[model samples]
Structure formats: structure tokens, C-alpha cells
Target: MPQEAGLRSFFLAGFECATQRRADGKRLDLLASTRHDAHVAKDYARIREHGMRAARDGMRWHLIETAPGFYDWSSVAPMASAAAEAGVQVIWDLCHYGYPDGLDIWSPAFPERFARFSKAAARFLAEQGDEVRYFCPVNEMSFWAWAGGDMGRFNPTARGRGDELKRQLARATIAAVDAVREVDARARFIVAEPSINVAPNGDSEQAIADAANYCEVQFAAHDMLVGRLNPELGGSPDKLDIVGVNFYPDNQWVLGGPPIPLGQYNYRPFREMLKETCERYGRPVIVSEFGAENTARPAWLYYVAQEVAAAREAGAPVEGMCFYPVLDYPGWENDRCCDVGLFGDADANGDRCVYAPLAEELRRQRVRFEGEFAAANDERMTPLRREAS
Candidate 1:
């Protein structure tokens, strides 16, 4: 219970945990994958197997409460039950992107649909009692809208920022969170938003401002959802209870330097963000998602833990930091899967494969750190860090 320093994180897994691949070989994330329900079950089974303390599981409102008045959560319930039995805390995510079969973004019934589904889900879990406390009403609201509608990364791939999409998503999230609380007064939320960085190619002042605005745009929906979009150029932080920060080894840049390789980004910003978020919102923060690609993962976990500890010491209310997954799945790039595993891999015959050394080292570091982290180094406070694995 790192609750005192407000440090704790969910053990998130199953982005495509049970999703089957598209026939043409393209794939969608957890939400869009038709195999979501099955993958969720398998992932929950493994979560119990590992004795993980907390999990970031999702319940897509669009899927469960389609057709306005109809409700169908038969699939997600068993996983919630399993978590309760295992004594693991559940940080349920209400939406990760994607909508129902026939719903439009601007449908008049959108808010009510989300609210009803969220309340039902919450009541269902509350009846189970005590085990599920945390909730993420919507995961990465800005990224999803951008990627799906504007950026064309996922479904409904629309281009450019859509304020209407943003508002609809925020409204649904607010309604869902509010609905859940009605069922369980103790429900806590960690609203996740991907922290993106888009630095300029040159060393001009305009580049600096562009980079700052890039970051600001990433924070917009989160700001509005939290009730901070009005006064402070986006000064709302009410709908957000615990600011859910998702940083990755791939999410970084150089002001004028070469891009760091995918696996080499540092944890300095994570620490700084925790401190700043706590100071700004006066609420606990959660490193909802954090991990690296394919090398020196043990060291990655070690440094992340160290950074988390450092944030806590500095008076940042960090609730928890999560390791994305315990194992990897092959064919990740093919859209069938993504290899963000923390454990060593094995083949169909169960033999050790790539990243064996990294996995072993991760175990060692996890043991060595023993849930402890260091304070943020004052000399290293400036964002440009020199440390490398």
C-alpha cells in the first residue's frame, strides 16, 4: 500500500489480450478487437496466476449497452468476479475507443447510454464488494479521438482535431464517472491520456512554442474533463480524480538533437509530471501505463521504480505505476499482437526465446527494488537526461 506517498499503479495487460486478428491481417486495439471478451478472460486468469495487486481492465459501454435500452455485460462480469476472488484491485476502464454498431458521435442519447451502462457496471461490481475500487471512465480520450477520427490510426479514422468528438467523449466520461460513484461511493478514478511530444526540427523559438503547444494539445481533453478548461486556458481538474499519465519509452524527442532510439527514452519526465500534476490538481496521480520496447527491461523497471520513489519523496501523490504486461505475444507488428512483455518468452513448445536475459534481469531488479524508489535528483531536474542503459 504505497497510499501514503500516494504511489500505486495497476498491472495493465491485454490491449489485445483476447482479440483475434482481422482476416486481411490488420488488427485493432483492445476495444475494437472482436476477441475482446475472450482475451479479457485469459488475461484475467493470468493476472490471478501472478498474484498481481491491481489490474487495468475495461468495460466498453458501447458494446454492453448497445441499442439504447438493451444491456449486455455477460462477458465482463466473470473477469470482475475473478479479480474479486484473487483480492486484486480493479481499475476498470469504461471506454478505450470505438463505439457501438449503430451509434453516431453526436447522437442525442449518447450521454444517457454511457451513464446507464456505467451505473449498472458499478452496481454489479459493488455488489461483489471491496475488490474493485478504481475506475478509468475513459482511456486516452484525446488520443483515441485523434487516432480514430483525425489521425486515421484506428477506426472511424477522421482527420484533424474535432471539438465535437472531444466534447462528446468528455461528456460520456463525466457521466460514466458520476454514475459509478452512485453505485459505490468509494470509487476512485485514474483518467488516462497519452502524453505526446512533437518537437521541431530546428532550434528556432517558434519550434519551442510548437513543441509546447503540442504538449498542450495532448493535455486538452484531460484538462476539460478534469474541469480545468475555462480559466487556466484549460484550468479544469474536477472530473479527473487521479490524473492518469501514460508515458512510454517511445514517446520522446530532442529539441535539436537526433531522436533517441525507440527503446532509450528516459523516466525523468514521468517524475517531473507526477510532481507537477500533484501540485496543479492537488490530487493523486497514477502512471497508468509505462514500459519500454525490447532491451534492458530489467533496468527499465528498476529506473521506473526509482523514479516513482523519487516522485513520492518530492511530495507527488503517485498512486501506482504499472508494468504493461507480464509476457509478450508474437506477430505484434502484424496487427495481431504487440510485444510489450515483462516476462521471458517461450515458443509454442514452451521454450525460452528472445529477451531471456532481459526477463531474468527484470526479476532481479523487481526483487532488488522491493517496491522502493529514490527521490528525484536535483542536479538531474532539467529534462535533458544523460543516463543510458
Candidate 2:
């Protein structure tokens, strides 16, 4: 539990702050596309009013470091100040799947530049005098490698080179963490990597082993960060501070097959997944990103909340849950409205239309979780265990 060490609240909202070049070679600034860049203060205010005291937002690396060895705080400083003014605690992401165009991702220069950026960003936030500071240096290393290196979905656009890209990202991440610590020792990091599961479709030995191996691959980035797999890259136990695991409906599937529907015979329980993750890493875990699209959003939260509670009761250090993309935005590929956030896109005044159904469910879960914590005066608490009749 560690009351003082945990986030300002048990729930958090994440904005779509991705700033990256698309397959079409167009640079997409999500904060601008969603109008959050101009309405930073308003967005923070609205999220606070929703009863969430914490948020997950990011900076655009491409915009800030416009020139080599030169830094510009113009775009990011105001947003950080806005969050502080609105009284909303934020987990600032330094590099959200995008870096400067001139810097090659695989080049040693990439890590060098990122480390410098991390130091600068950390100093900026440290000077703000915030009590609790959280950061995600590199978001979703696993997915990014697959998309950018292997699948050619985004930047780097290399094919069949996901592993190489993953390692390069890991190296940069390690460097960034070190640099941040140098500037602000109190800064906490949230290593958010995708949580996934894979299974064999058939009953053959080879199929089962292959499926299991693929499933184990999801932890590669985490292992590297924690000094488990890649000690040669300066990884160590301290590298892994707080782990944030992102899970979605389609996160688990049979290898080379379709998704295993939650609650089905073939599906692994969400509680089991959380427990396994916590046990392996032995650090605090957050369901950092969890939400469904449209009508299923509310139902999805209930199921995830129940599983999180169960995992906590089972002695897993499940710290909290974050409903990511708390604000809706256009799709990355087609710019179509995803309609998946708790609040719709901002109107003319930067006001968002809250989805009543999702908001109600969020309120219910918040009250219930607050009550669960209220009974425990201990900072370190196991989940509220129910008594058997």
C-alpha cells in the first residue's frame, strides 16, 4: 500500500499525447488534433472535476528539440504549469513513441540525445515543486518495436527487425532513466509495457511450446529494464521502479489465431494475469491502461475492477487502475472518431461531452474502491479480503 509512495489517487486519466510521423510521412500531433495543446488548463480542470486527482500526459519530443543540442521548453512548460495550477497530479511521458527526425533510432546518438532530453525534462518538473512526480520514458516498447520495426507501421519503418529495435529502445530507456535520476532523484518512473497472453491452438507438443515461448516474449522489455535479461546494457534491479501493465480485450489470444474472449473456457482470468505479472517483477503494478470502445466501456471497467480486486485480495501488489485516453480523439490511421473515452472531443470552449453511462460506472467504482481503502489504516495493505460465510 505505502500510502505516501502511491499516486495522489487510485484512479488516473491519460490523454492522447502521441506525436509521431505517420506511414504517410505526415507528422501527427495528437494534442493538437484533439485541441488539448491549446486547452491544457481546461482539460486538467475537467478531469479533476471527475474525481480523478491524477493523470497520464506526454510531451512531444519532436516539437521541443527542434535543433541538435538545442532545447525548447515553450511547448511543454505551459502544460506542466497548467497541471500544477489545476491541482491535478500528472505522470509526464518524455518520449511517447516518437523522437526527433534527424536522430536515427538505432544510432548511439539516439540514446545520447534522449538522455539529455530526460535530464532537461526532469529538471523542468522538479523546479515546479510538485510533491509526487511520475514519468514514462518510453511508452510501449514491445508494441512500438512491432509496429515501427517489424510491421513497418510507423517511424523507422523497418521490416523483420523488431528485436533489434526493441533492444535499441531498451538502451535508450536505460539511458533516459539514468539521466532523469541525475537531475531529480525523487522522480518516479512508470514503465508501461503491454500485457499480453498467447496460447497454442492445438494439443500438439510443438504448438504448445511455441505458444508458450511467444507468450513469454511479452516480458522481454520488462526483463531488460529490470536487469534480468540484458545486464550488458547497464540494466539492474533499480532500473525497474514502478511497473504499469496495459491490458486490453484483445491482449490475449491463441498464437496465430483469434482472441480468447474474456470469461470463456479458453480465456485466462484477468486476476491471474495481474498476479503473474506482480509475482514475476515483484514491484507495484497498475492496470495503467484499460478501456473498451462505445457501449462495452462500462462493462469492461466492471470486469477489470473485479479482477483487480481479486488480484489484490490474493496478495498481489495491485496499486491502482487508470482509464487511459480519458478523452476521446480521432483514430491514428483514418482520423475517424474512436468514441472510446470517458469524455468526447472538446467543443468550441474546450468543454468535453461526458458519456453518462461511463461516468456513472466510474463513480460507482471510485466510491467502492475508496471504501475498500478506508477500512485499512496501514499504508501497506493487501486487497480487502472477503470473509466466507
Candidate 3:
């Protein structure tokens, strides 16, 4: 982990803020649905109590810019103020798979419009007392391209156009970085995408090669942003900063088959994936989003923490791990509750019940990290110790 990243704590809380429209034409606002928007002050304070002095949140572009060239900060101002007041450092997501209505994602003007929005957002955050701004220009570009473009599961439902959608997202991301930098040159960016492993179901040579190729597609967006691939999109190394690898238990799967069991022979160790990402990008990496539902939560966190510890010892620049959706949210497709957060759904008073098992596991991991890093005299441990204490 680089000291320059300046994360306030080793563990981070990620609020579920996806504002995507489903295939059924229903737009979802997770922040609102989870009541985090209304209770942001209490939410930030709660995370601090849990030793998470930093968070990943989002800005709803649709609500902020309801019309062309018009800006509204009413929806975001309170959250920003709460973070500042609670002393929680936030990495804002500019677009979490949702955009303004009537905006054509394929048109040249799409990137242009997003750039302007990014500029405005940067300036606004700066004005709100965020001296050093951190932003994820677009969350999970590869996943979004596949879900909305290739699978027709979300907005702009089109099939067999994943690559084209990915390229356009790359263009938008590049434009956003430039636009943000124009507002504040010191602004940092996190390009978060899902990290996965695809295994061949059979021993056939063609199946093996196909699986490998499919796995490689995960890096297309990162490569594009760094100008390693699709240089025509105007990507350069500067556009790529911190690499955020979003991993879940189901990330590894057999080609054309079901998910690989956790202890299966073909299931890749999370450490190896973390190390590969760091080496591939030559930049700081963070487990930007990761969590499991119900009873699997504690075990999953334990697995990830141990793997991250091993990765760090092996010289991977793993910076931080974010327990995504720190507050449980309603399901995107169905309104059913997803019991995956450290905190349950908010009550009328904007308070939530803590999931004790996961919270205990998180505390244990924090202590373990503090001890290991302290023994190694790792400078990065300083912030963790200070925050956790």
C-alpha cells in the first residue's frame, strides 16, 4: 500500500448506491431505499464506531441533473455535509450504472455530458470542504457492459454489444478523469471492476483456451483506461489510478457451468488474484467491493482478510478492503431484503440493528492486521492503529 493513498482506515464501509434502471424499466435508488440518504449523519457516525473512518458512496446523476446543462445538488449536499461532519473520508462514485433520462449512452454527446457532470461534481465537493477529492468515475464498467449491453438485464437493454458498450464507457471514464482534473488537479480516481476466474469444465484444449480468453476479458476496461488496449479512445496511464477489484464468492466459475465451490481444486486463491492485479497495473489496489449474504458473511470476511494479509506479505500493494453495502438494501430485481450488511435496514429513527457476528469478525480482522503490520513495522499500519484504537 502506498502512503500517498491516504485512506483513514484499513477497513472501509461501502454504502450500496446503485441507481440503475432494471430491465423491467424500474429505476432503483438504493441509497434512498436503504434510508442512508436520510440517515447519513448517523450512518457515518456508526461506521466510525466500527473503526471505518472511510466510505465509498455515490452521486445519483439522474437526480442531480434532471435536465440538460442544469445542476442540482439538493440530493447530495446533506450526505456530503454529514461525511465532513463525521470525519469520514469518502470516495464518491459519479455513475453507479445510472444516467439521466433521455441521454443516449451510445451518442458522442454522452461522454461529453458526463464530463460536464464530473466537473461540476468535483467543484461541488471541493466547495463542500473536501480538499482532496477521490472519485470512481464509473463503477464496474466491465460488469455494466455485460449486464446492460450483452445480457439485456438492465437499462439500454441490448444484446451482443458488450464490447461496444465497454468502449463507450472507457471513453466516458477518460473524459470524466479529464473533466475532474480540470476542476482539481490533485483529484484521485478509482477504476473499480469485478475480478473473476473462469475455469474450463472439461479437459478439452479448446475449452481451456476459451476459458482463459473469457477470463482475460475482465481486464479490458482497465487496459483501455491505461492505454494498454484501445488507445484510440484517448486513454493514458494517468487515467488509471488505484485499481479496485470487486470480488465475491461466486466470482469464480466453470465456463458454461455453475460457480466453482470455494475449496474446489480450480478455485483460485484470492491472494493470487490480488497480487496479479497489483503487478498488472503497477498501482495500488483495493478490495473495493466485497461481501456475502446471511450466515456466509463472517466466513467470507475471514477468508478475504487472511488472503489479503498473505498478499501484502508477498509484496502485493493491497491498500484497503471495503465491506460493501455496510447497510443492507432491498434487492434490485425484487424488493426482498438482502441480509448482507453489517447494519440491518434503518428504523423509523434512522437507526439500524448490527449484525453481531460480522461485526465481531471485522473487529478480529482489524486486530490481526494491526498486530501483523505492527510487527513488520509497516508504516501503513499507523493509520489503522490510530483509527481502530
Candidate 4:
């Protein structure tokens, strides 16, 4: 282990299933595909150069074993291998969303299928075991269930309230952990979920209750992953190594309150949320995903770094912070996706050689938080004076 630097920077790697690829002369969704692409390996190499020790990659159970008892590792193996070779660690996300297409999510076989895929993935990785140790069984389970199951945003768009989604996602998380432990008992699980602070209408009692419930609701995934269900969720709390928070400005909002424009949301709001999450869970926190769009991002960078420092000073076990993407992704909602990348795009040959100023700003902020080193002036490490002899 690299002496627990107290803060870390990581790159995001969307799994084969979650990637939206330009193909068939048009964009095709690969959220449930098992086929791997060569481009991913190339991308990983580029990402590794950006000072990331950890990479957040997604893994879909549905894609790996599309049919009963059938398995395929071709899609993920290269990227995992690439990460290992590059000396980068991976926090593999299993089952971001959707089923293998034929199976119903409500079916009894869902949990077992997920477990099988996880176990197989863990086994293979362990067989090749280098530094790959962390596993995030599911990413943002509460939001996914709500969006996919309740809100109908993505596939398997079943509409329901918060409870069902919470329950099913929790079960899947449990099964996933069990599977991984079967293969690698020492594997650490990072539970990544959306952390939203719902500011209700004024200080009314109902509003307070609503806010509390909302906190718990967002915590549903973390609670279950660490086995915290208790009297309500019907099981013990699962073990959570890191509480991964995917927070964007949009996620923090008031009930029916006028939307706070993206530029208006500041670092204070994020700091408070980070503090609250730490206070609530009493676990080490990682701002798993954080970034903004359409502005002078260096200012944004300075502000976020200040807030992260505050989180650390306040005694929150904030282990690391990840900027989500090193390059912009095409066609995400509201052009926000395109803007989030630190490197906007590449040259004609797809060779990524330029770093956007925003990335420089990110680097700048990291240095401020981690402290700067003067090449020949620092006293913590130095050579003895030869004149003494």
C-alpha cells in the first residue's frame, strides 16, 4: 500500500455494458453487451498517465452471462489487464443497470445470476491478481432502481416508489459481495451511491422529516451494502469499506424550489453534503464523482479543493476524490457530459496528446491540497552536506 496519502485521484472507466458507442453508423447502447472493443485498452492507457492510481470501471452481470451457464471474459479482460500492467488499481462496478435482455429482473433467478457473474469475475481477477482489490458491486443502486424501475428513464422501466428499488438493489449488492469473497476473500467493497441533500420548504416539521427520510433514502444502498437494513430492510448491515458518493450540483435541490442554475451552486453546498454523509455513516468517504460544466473551471477547482480540505479537517475519513472523466464523453444530456472531460477531444488519428486547461486546474487544486514540493528546498527529504567530511 502506498502509505495512505490521505487523498487520492482516480479516473473513471465505464464498463463495456455502460458504454455508448458509435457503431452501425449510428450510436448503439452497449449497457448489456458482452463484446469487448480494442478502443477501451487504448483509452485506459491514456487515462493512466493522468496521475490516477484507481480507475472506476463498470461490470454488468447481464452482459457477461447473457444466457444461462454461459460465460465470456473477452470484453473486460483487456481493460483489467491494462490496468494491472499500468500499475493502476481498479474499483470494479458490477451491474450498473439492466438485465441480460431475456431475464426478468423480478424473477427469483436475478440474485443468483448476479452472484455467479461476480464470483466468476473475482476468480479470474484473483487468478491474475496484482493490485486489483476493490469491488463496487453496484453503482448508485437507489437512483438506478428509481430511474430504471420507478422513473422509467432507462430499461426495465418499472414504475414504483423507493422501497422496492431499495430492496432489490440491496439484495443484489449482498449477493455480489458474497460472490467476490468466494473468489477473493481479501477484496474490499466500495459502495458508490448518489448523495443528495433535499432541502425542503422552510423549517416546518414535515420538511424536517422529509429531509431525514431523504437522507436515509439516499443512504439505502450504503446501508444495505454494509448490512444496515435492521428492522426495516429485514437483514443485517453489509460491510462497506468506502462510502463512494456521486454528487453533482443538480442532485442537491429544494422540493419544488426554483432550480439553482449550474453556475450558481458553490463549494459550500458540496462541503456540507460531504460532512453530512460522513457524520451520518461514520465511514471513510470518497467523492467518487465530482465536476461541473460551462464555466471557468479553475475557480470551480479551487473551491472544490477548499471544500475537500475542510472535509478532511473536520475529521471525515475522506480517502480520495475522483474527477469522473479525463476526457469528454459525447451525447450525454444537456451537453454536460461533453464538458465534464478534462481533455475535451483528440486529434484525427484519435491520439490524445493535449490536456485541457481545466485538467491543469484540476492538477493545480490537487497540489494545493496535497502540498507542493520545492525540488531543492524541501527539508523532509535531502542529502547530507558533503563538506562536513
* Candidate with maximal TM-score: 3
Better of 1 and 3 by TM-score: 3
- The sequence of per-residue lDDT tens digits that candidate 4 reaches over residues 94-193 is 7766457566666667777887878888887887775447787877787777776776656555677446766776777777787788778778777778
Which wins on TM-score, candidate 1 or candidate 4?
Answer: 4
Model 2 score (lDDT)? 0.84
Model 4 regions more than 4 Å off: 1-37, 230-238, 261-268, 332-337, 346-348, 353-355, 373-389
Q: Taking the tens digit of each residue's C-alpha lDDT, what string does model 2 give over 1-389?
A: 33223787788898888877778887878889998888899888877766677889998999888898678889988898898898788888888888888888888899999999888888877888857578899999999999998998889888999999999889989999999999887878888888888879899999999999988888999889878887788788788888889988999998898998987787888899899998997888998899888888889999999999999899988888888888788999999988778877777888777787777677778877776443233233222122211
Write model 3 residue lDDT over 188-236, tens digit each, in one string. 8998999999999889999999999998999999999989999999999
Model 3 error, position 162 (Å): 0.6
* Most lDDT-accurate candidate: 3
Q: What is the lDDT of residue 362 in candidate 1?
A: 40
RMSD of each: 7.8, 5.9, 4.6, 7.8
For model 1, give the RMSD to the true fold: 7.8
Off by over 4 Å in 2: 1-5, 372-389
Can you tell me which runs of candidate 3 are displaced by over 4 Å? 1-3, 371-389
Which consecutive 10 residues in model 1 have the weakest lDDT in total? 377-386
Clashing pairs in 2: 2-379
Query: What lDDT is obtained when candidate 3 is compared to the true structure?
Result: 0.90
Q: What is the lDDT of residue 302 in candidate 3?
A: 98
| Cα error of candidate 1 at position 38, Å | 4.5
| Clashes per candidate, residues 3 or more apart or on different chains | 27, 1, 0, 8
